[model samples]
Target chain A: MSSATLEIVEPGLLTTVQDAGRYGYQRFGVPVSGAIDVFALKAANILAGNAQDAAGLEMTVVGPRVRFLADTWIALTGADLGPLLDDRPIPMWESVAVPAGAILSFDGARDGVFGYLAVTGGIDVPVVMGSRSTYVKGAIGGHLGRALMASDSLPTMERDGHPDPTNNRLPDHLGAPRYGNTHEIRVVLGPQDAAFTAEAVQTLLGSEYSVSIQSDRMGYRLEGPVIQHRSGPDLISDGTPLGAVQVPGDGQPIILLSDRGTTGGYAKIATVISSDIGTLGQAMPVDTIRFATVSVEEAHAILREREQVLRDIEKAVRGAAAEAVSIRIDGDAFEAVDDSGRLVSAPAVEGRVESEATRHARVTVDGRTFEFDVEVQRAD
Target chain B: MREDLRFLPAGDQAVVVELGDTIDPQTNRRVHGLMDAIEREEVPGVFDLVPTYRSILVYYDPMLTSLPELQARVSELYRDLEDHAVATPRTVEIPTLYGGEYGPDLEFVAEHAGLTPQEVIDIHSGTDYLVYMMGFSPGFPYLGGLSERLATPRLDTPRLEIPAGSVGIAESQTGVYPVASPGGWRLVGRSPVRMFDAEAEPPSRLAAGDYVRFVPIASETEYLKLQESAVKGIHAGDAAQ
Candidate 1:
């Protein structure tokens, strides 16, 4: 058998292999570089039947064109990049099985700045300092510590079991986050809010800030009303956390992200909540952002709610796999499955089936009944 | 708990413990001391600790440990930090080649300090500087104890790219750039040593609570030989006397 691989035909702008993050080395000034949209990355991995922290490809603005070297399960999430599989539009937020030699391409992003592509068993990359994330500035981790280029052949891990294709889609009712040109981001005020005047805090909460063109994985610099400071902008350099909204002497606020320096001197007025960081990550250069302050307790509560939603998604996908069956309608076979109360049908060859001697058969899925005219054939 | 210690929440995952407002050696020692205490205790959910000039940022997983729980544990540790002994400082000697193309801003720095270029080198290499923190970029040390006489302002226009190992001075602070980056610091000399190597056992050459001593080399031929050896993985710091 041939080894599973993904050959890059055209590398997109700023495509990099990223996992959870590089942890435990911030003391030596190592940035924890990872996927900017953690939520989407996790969701993509889950849909592909990989671990939540598995390594995947993070594409910015434009996405890469690649060909699979072997038959494998894959998932696309994060942004609506107008992805096409073998010249056909594929559904987002679902597991898709691509045959060997199938080409996947994108026609630029319609909404959001970042998009994620995940494969079963995850991308095979050497884990450096406990992570596969790329820190391009320090030339550490990922594929040669830089963005992907054309002609790079990436290998995939060998997973233990097959992913159930029937119930692997995100239902419409449990809708994914929709990216737009405007975002209302929530933050927790201060490790250094005291350095700024009360009015400056008001300005941060009240005014609209446009995402500057200078934004990248390191930070999103905002151009908006001047956030006044009571004192100087300099602080004795301290550890900079992910989502730190730092305001410099220029009065511009830069929300630091995955690839920000481990420590910085600028005073941080607030930090975006964990649940909303992925939402901010999807904001484009010209997108307008408004800030809202939440208490630390409230932020944690929101995080818990987000975690519960993920759990619900996991249960919905995995729970329905047991009842998956193949149905034949008028001599044509279809994989009948429940996608969290949504009906899904796909062409399949295996599964327990119910065939009717009469012209119509009643099929029950997730407590809902549907009558279909079919030729009765028992595969068991 | 000490009256000076302030534990401020840095979002849901981290807490910044400020030891003092000033950037003095005493305060820095206490900062490292608290970090050492936390590390020795092996506190659950605490994943990373970043020690700076006068504070240590403690990063923890909120799912495993709540902010209030971490704060209570850290407060108790801060109260007993004095009992934790900070490791003895290591003085790493850096071999540097001074003047000419290597130090483009040397003449200007000397003119501003009212001294000859050689005098500037002498003053810079004479003192044993303290490494207060490693920040801004990977393995980039913020060294203190620059001579007041040699203190020079940053260049009017920042350089597009300062070569790695370039020793620079900005105001009262002096340090070496570990990687090539755009900077406005006044260059005095260039070191042959690699300040940071991701593949190395310890990525950063200098850590907080360490000392740096610059050793001047007279010949460019020796500098090239040292640079060559450094590329072959023979670090000059290990060979320093």
Candidate 2:
């Protein structure tokens, strides 16, 4: 129950272990390196009842073949890779129970450009500089402090299987992630908006650029219209953020991503809205990405809405777990299993157990059974 | 040109201070001093300030302060620190292995400098260079002050990869590539010491305003062990002893 081994049979285009991100320490010029599809990563971890920030495998378009040496619960989110649990089609966005010596394999991506595999207890990798994300350029953190190779083996740990009943609901409503050939990403004018000519700014927002093969964890090299500037180029090195669309001398826009350098010299005209960053994860080589302008206020509203949706999912999951008990349970300190099976204190006393919901139960100590009048719906 | 500053609106109560055509050292000094003055004043909404060679990019939480208020605060700081802006400098020495395989382009650099390969190494080792700034890749310093006699343009086509510690010249500037990357500079030598170790407290071996002097070594054999061990993630000091 201490650790398990994950041996890579074939390392795909790129498969690295990543956590939320390495934050702070920017003064030393360290990039905030981490997974691209954060929503999928968080969803996978939540389904397995692991910590939301737990590190997991981030597989690119070409996925890897791995063999787990022990039993565990795993959830595959992000790209629909046609994941097979013992050769049976397992649903995406749901946890799949695997027995000991199970082999999980994936072909190239089918729906999205990246996929995440989150185990119940999470990968037991050493954290460096306050994170487990791999910064390849800096060569710090994550399994042996580098990328996964063919013969690389990663150690896993026994999971407590404590599920957050609130986060267990399937996220199919967001739909199978779309990796459409052309994507229109929303953006807001950045701190350097006026640096470019008005026509150049219009071209950036109006053009449909094809993502070049040069795209990596650093940034996306986009090819489209030549955005000419009215002034001659002269840029001092400056700080830029992830999602900063920097148009360099050649006029091609490069959309910076996770693991981007701390600073840049290119004049940035706009920044992709934080809520739409997931669109970058879905873009593969030859994919087209369009930018639509939005007010900064609208961008903030979108971010808030996304955050609330994630929180609501977590709440529903926990509520469902508490509804399935049949016993007329008062606070007898009876051990209740969470969605992940780890013991947690039952909800505060005077908790009502609704009978219709199969996900949660309120057990009665003296053995009296009562069901709720109706299913309670949460207000938005 | 005289300096002028204006607040440009960036939606949702955010404004960026526009400093027109201020890409010179004199302006850089003024911009830096202004940033310092603002920090002393403790402007609201300002979360962080990133200063480059010429301009300062400020980040603030929009929920806390309005754009107009932040702009007013910056102008007040700018007007105060414009006169007293000067920075003291420091010098650092780098030991290098010149010529032979360690420096594949040593002959080319020598030819461009109108000297023999050994003489080229001497000229490079004899002079002190100034670090103008650090950019491009991490800890990759954009150095100035290479002698006009030794000026050389970058390779017509960049190499697929240049190893770390490789000392090279691109036009009038000389620098050491801190990380292995695709580069176009003309290599003339390489240093053994790690220039950009992430584990080190400072991370970068050199910083802006630091002075650099190259001290040359004749033997290429001295670098073989450090290069071999460094690539394998073992410190050269551990393997050398």
Model 2 — interface RMS deviation?
3.9
Stretches of model 1 off by over 4 angstroms after superposition: A1-4, A160-167, A171-173, A317-380, B116-118, B232-241
Give the per-residue lDDT digits (tens) of candidate 1, residues A204-291. 9999999999999999999999999899899888899989999999999999999999999899999998889899999999899999
- lDDT per residue (tens digit) for residues A295-351 in model 2: 876876776576555545454444564355322233322343434554354432333
- TM-score on alpha carbons, each prediction: 0.85, 0.73
Residues B4-110, candidate 1, lDDT per residue (tens digit)? 57877788778888888888877887777778788998776698889999888888877557887887888888876663466767899888988888888899889
DockQ of each: 0.47, 0.17
Model 2 stretches with alpha carbons more than 4 Å out: A23-30, A137-140, A157-167, A170-181, A191-195, A231-234, A286-288, A318-380, B1-51, B56-90, B97-132, B157-161, B208-241
Candidate 2 residue-wise lDDT at A170: 59
Highest DockQ scorer: 1
- Model 1 interface RMSD, in angstroms? 1.1
